[model samples]
Target: MTSSLQAALDPSAIAVIGASENPDKIGGRPLLYLSMFGFRGEVWPVNPKRDEVQGRRTVPRLSALSRAPDLAIIAVPGEAAVAALDECGEVGVKVAIMMASGFGETADPAAQAAERAMVARARARGVRMIGPNSQGLANFGTGAVPSFSSMFLEVPPQDGPVGIVSQSGAMSVVPYGLLRGRGIGVRHTHATGNDADVTVCELAAAVAADPALKLLLLYLESIPDPHHLAEAAAIARDRGLPIVALKSGRTAAGQAAAQSHTGALANEDRLVDAFLERHGIWRADDTTDLVAAAELYLKGWRPGGRRMVAISNSGATCVMAADAASAAGLDLTP
Candidate 1:
């Protein structure tokens, strides 16, 4: 396996720093889901306040651990998260998931400053941080599920070939569940909450290089660096891997709200559309469209020069499809 793929899939052991015994709590769900999903890796819970969480002995701190975990998931409050990350870095943990918020989104100036400090600390230590405000991430290929939402509550992990990257945590899970319901499998799903360090562009470039990944689906509220994203999209296009993007915050009002929420600036919707087109990336209008387009591409059919042939049992359905295609700027002459 390639080094990047190995690194992505080789998170053999994980530690939950704020794990709790209570099933309802945020820290308890990763442990619960990991066990229930039948993860093959070792699971450790670290909580100073608890003797044991979910029948597993809890380590008071990362310093007390014998072996270094490949990945660490921090579910503690925003204030304590930086310290936990520092401890993770000291232990030589490679990747970290920060599920706590109170960073860029918080209206308070002090909170934003604290968030910046956290990012700076992580960067200085050379540790890769996922989010100071995020839902979580999952590697279905390796059974590394580290998300907290009850969305994975009743579902079994369905391993597949598509890798998902989304800015919205809640939206990420929704697509996973939806795609699985439609018999599409996911290789990895990442919710990049308040992307302080790892941007969508970096993740997409990494996913493009992943041998296990056949397709990439992105749900983006805003792109921080258009140049970086364009370059990444170009790489994906060059590799002949299909990238389907669903862009939120398309309208002026929606853009304003997104900017306030993530401290991001949304570019003109038309400019984004042109950029994606130029990079050979497919644009999806809605959630269903996003999944459908991704599924079609992954199943190995590519459109020839934007021309499409319509087939329908009913005249009305055929006409509707033609109209939709025309509206989407697709050629339907054939």
Candidate 2:
């Protein structure tokens, strides 16, 4: 699955295709967060209509740039996204995070067709697309601030041992921030939107091989391709790298919502649960469990089997920990 295209790019120097002057706009947030966090890479702004954005000189187009950017973040309107991507491909941009919507979710059939065409065109050029409808991707390991969400504004760059591969962009930042706040380090983070080319399986496979990474936390709405996911999970298990997965869309209503969001069907929740158990992957039911499981694993605590030793300062706390652990399907003994 390794390609020269993935190896050649720095994953550092990123260009914002729809960089805007308004901080409230989508494109403006990444620029703002990147500058605020002091990302130590050349941040290029590609917007022909603007001379400057966020105090940086904006390049009229990607082709006019003196240096080819390793990655491009697309924040333009859905109608212009493909055109921006065409420019990115011409300039040899390796990875692109398409933050525009109006693709599969649109009520108009023509719009959906156009979105598919854009994806086909980009893939044909050997350029990887992350989302036509996505929050955006981020790589904290390389100081790549590609997401435009304001949540990252308060986050500082800290490369640790855990890698977060999330399908939901909103979950990525929130989880990353919470884990980082708790002193757990993150090596890399990705929010795979739409997953047009790079799926969560591929992302997990890549993370499993990262020498600096010891833990992987995933927030998945649904596993679109179970075979690929199973293969990736097996790889992670072989490496003794524990994966804590929070699989959303458990209920019928939630499943419907997940499908609507990404046009993906939520696999049978029981099947996913059984699959994770067979692979030695921990399943988290809520945000607290997700964080606790990851934190415990990252800190080198592992149960010999499902049995765990519990210690608490108070009886109520002890009872709670035991109940919580049992509810998570872990045996709390001794």
Candidate 3:
């Protein structure tokens, strides 16, 4: 059965565990974002220290909630993360996000073990986990800004046709920041940190179902579930939507960094190249390359012919345009 990313991606209600009042902090940022971004759902902020967070009244703890929320954000410290998961599962919460780090990514035996335990507990309770060391997730469609990313703070979120799902938190919003800077609006931007449960591929498949999303971008350190990703690619292809992938681990250095960050084993680089092409997904090198061709794709310009001709009054403009076309893999007649 395909795992529907409904609960995690667009929850009806959210429980912010370890919620805070400070907008800069991890717990508090989501509260502020949900408020400012116009999330039309119930937000229960769990923290005993405050009566309210970002103007939303705090609920003291998850147990005191009147009803079980669809999703839980574990913004508590590493020590309190798993315990918070247990409580969320008891309340029938379907998805929980562990935004805290020091899990398997730490490479320490205890940290790895802790990550394993967290996954196991979630499995037993039938609750899906998002990350152990993640930046969190954001859905502009639902205004579910459960992420603590400072990127959204710097660059305001605008709903549009692009969907971003990445293995790295930085990779997720960096492209969003770029797109917004270029006046391109993005609908979904998600970071599947550690990939403990909800993988980038699985989440991508879910977001691909959105009728409004015209372009889907993925940033991967490892291909955890190729079969699932294949399904997502197929869906996007059927809808005439395009998927672009930025698969890291190209060199020993990037591979080592990916391993330390996500605990993901590096797949062979050439194989990854073939995999992306075989699935109709264009492979990108960096954040810039990932969103570089985005505006062109969004313009809905269907090519009439493979012929290339540049027309401009200024010779300088024609030469510059020709160089850019060649760089972007577009045919240009010299």
Over 4 Å off, model 3: 1-4, 302-334
The local distance difference test score of each candidate is: 0.78, 0.76, 0.88
lDDT rank, highest first?
3, 1, 2
Tens digit per residue, CA lDDT, model 3, 112-184: 9988887888788888888878788899988998999999989988999999999899999999999999999
What does each candidate score in C-alpha RMSD?
2.8, 3.4, 3.3
| Model 3: ten consecutive residues of lowest lDDT | 1-10
User: lDDT per residue, candidate 2, 1-334, as tens digits?
Assistant: 3552253123657899889988779988888867765578889998888888989999888888887787888999866888998877787887788888777655567867886787788777777877777776555665566677666667665778888888777777788888878977776677776665667767666667666778888888878776777776777777778888999999999888876776556789899899888877789888788887776787776555877777877999889998889887888875
TM-score for all predictions? 0.88, 0.85, 0.90
Rank list by TM-score = 3, 1, 2
Stronger candidate by TM-score (2 vs 3):
3
Report the C-alpha lDDT of model 1 over 237-312, residue by residue, as the tens digit: 7777788898888888988777666655687898889888888778888998987776678878765587888887
Off by over 4 Å in 2: 1-12, 106-108, 155-157, 305-334
Whose TM-score is greatest here?
A: 3
